[model samples]
Target: MVMRWWSDRWTQSAGAFFLEKDAIFFASARDFLAGVLAAVVITCWNLAAVERNAIVQASQKPYQTLSSRYLYKTHKAKSGRNIHDASFRVYRSSPAMAELLLFEDIFTITGIDTDGKKFDKVSRIEARSEQFDMQLVLDVNIDVYPIARTDKFTLALSSTLRLDGTPDDGVFDQSRKKSLADKYEYVMYGKLYKYDDDESGGAIKIGVYVSFGGLLMMLKGDKQHLGNLKLDQRLYLLMRKV
Candidate 1:
């Protein structure tokens, strides 16, 4: 009888010990799960805050209309020079020699114009660019498109108006086909006749010259911007006011 009573007491002690171990295990598991949940909540909150900040920053940034790939230059006109007094001797030379040698292909492109001066002809205007502090002399057909002083504009030289970068047949289409020129107010067909690099104001400047019929354009600036231009290539000059 004494042995049986001792066995019962040992069984009770064993059961109590097992129950205490189970309670400790459950408590630790619950605490671990709660920590995990708290970490997840904190991480989600941080991500959401970051996204909200990004949206705010984007909204505050200025909107840019033109893509850098096709844009050749952007300028605000400082002043209008005297067209009559402005020498066209540098740009007046005929482009026929270059035009006669190359075949034409069209591709997508766009830009803006800044300041203008009416030349000897009522239909023509001579202009310059101001943004990059570069030397620019541009001649446009005022009869076709008029540009005033202190105007802000961008210019692009493109081979075609196709957005897909495919070459267009050298034919004018009046169809519903959308083109890069649609975004611009003034458009002209021209050929890049010359490209030159020279030192100006203690800096190296690259020059691009193009002729639209008899109208001419000379853009001289940093090479990083004008490096894509090719000589004797047919291009479309697109311009719009900002």
Candidate 2:
């Protein structure tokens, strides 16, 4: 069942709008929501420290065009002129296929065909200012695979990601700039999952092993050791589609 209710919106738009952030609640009691809500997540958007008010400020800027007002502004800026914007639109949809616009400050596209083939690519992204401007023209490639119970376990790899840039906020870059790179990246591999349902509470279990190398390494250069990291994969007891 679906329900609609009214609440206060902090923005000056000054009208009631539908709340699209749905929650999937699992219930242990029969009186409440007895099962988990099937809120599927095909995409995700991650924003930094910016708040709801910052987007409102950006929306009112003179740069906003007449035709772009309907797009959803998902990203936010913390200080000065740094800002980001994104929008997701369904470009095409059919009985068993779909194409979606992946908007995460940057823009990209993903298409899933009826025959289970998928294509993902990232194109041009623009960010400009009065003093400096940079445009990301790199193309992104994505690959996916569906694994079943019998799939064998694989090795893990670890690596680092480095970010380097200096701000122009009245500070001089005297060649001694600091980097925003990753200290270390950790990785783990899980092969088996075990679930039990009896009078004792239902439980799900999985077997996992870790490695500091291979595709699991997400750290930058070996400047320092920030200690071992933990995995961040969600768990679910998946029942095979018979």
Candidate 3:
């Protein structure tokens, strides 16, 4: 009987403690529910904030509302371009860079057309650099398109960087002034089908496609020779200097 009485007292005491804390527990529950509702509302609102017209609309806003508008301004429909297109980069070279190509002996390679037009040096060789010109070694390459194909021929080849007065890679580490033409394995492409002048001496036709390889070197020749390089770890071809 005593044990049963003590058990009833313990149960009553536990109930009283729960009643006392009920107010605080209910307040906490309300707070937790409000927090959950606020978080869901915020997430939904944020998702709606992102839109496809974001760039165009955002670009029109003031600096206070959208500080990043200036960068995306060009993305507008009328602009139709990107900011990166405006600027570019290139490497530095030595004053005497390196003579990458040198024709020690260029002989009497002459020809005449049937049209009564006399030509002196007729054997034309095509190299990799778009700016390469044996007559004026400076334009050997540029940042423009090197490979081209017209009604005549499709030319393609490469050359190694000539490291002489400067480093081969054209980095601005050491400043040396000189044209550096390093040794290059000159390559040329020729076609099998040949071209010959008419009996009346018309235009002379050339081969369809042929390949040639020779030892040509590059030194620190000129800095402005190649307009811009494609950036290395690639096969660069140079032409033989006749």
> Best lDDT goes to which candidate?
1
Cα lDDT tens digits for candidate 2, 56-121: 664543221112212223222344222333442323222211111100111121222323333343
**What is the TM-score of each predicted model, taking all chains together?**
0.49, 0.14, 0.22
* Model 2 lDDT at residue 135: 17
Q: Please list the residue runs of candidate 3 whose C-alpha ends up more than 4 Å from where it truly belongs after superposition.
A: 1-10, 19-23, 43-242
Candidate 2 TM-score versus the reference: 0.14
- How does candidate 2 score on lDDT? 0.23
The candidate that wins on TM-score is 1
- Lowest lDDT sum, 10 consecutive residues, model 3, at 63-72
Instruction: Tell me how candidate 1 scores on lDDT.
Output: 0.58
Q: Report RMSD for candidate 3.
A: 17.8
Tens-digit per-residue lDDT, 1-242, candidate 3: 99999999999999999987997899999999999999999998877777645755744532110111111111233353222212112323222322332111111212212234222322232222222221211122211212112211112232333443222442322444422221211233221122122233352322111122221222111223322322222333333221
Q: Estimate, for each residue in 187-214, the C-alpha lDDT of model 1 and write its tens digit.
A: 7787888888889678788888898887
Poorest 10 consecutive residues of model 2 by lDDT?
97-106
Candidate 1: C-alpha RMSD to true structure equals 16.7
Which whole-number lDDT from 0 to 100 does residue 207 have in model 3?
17
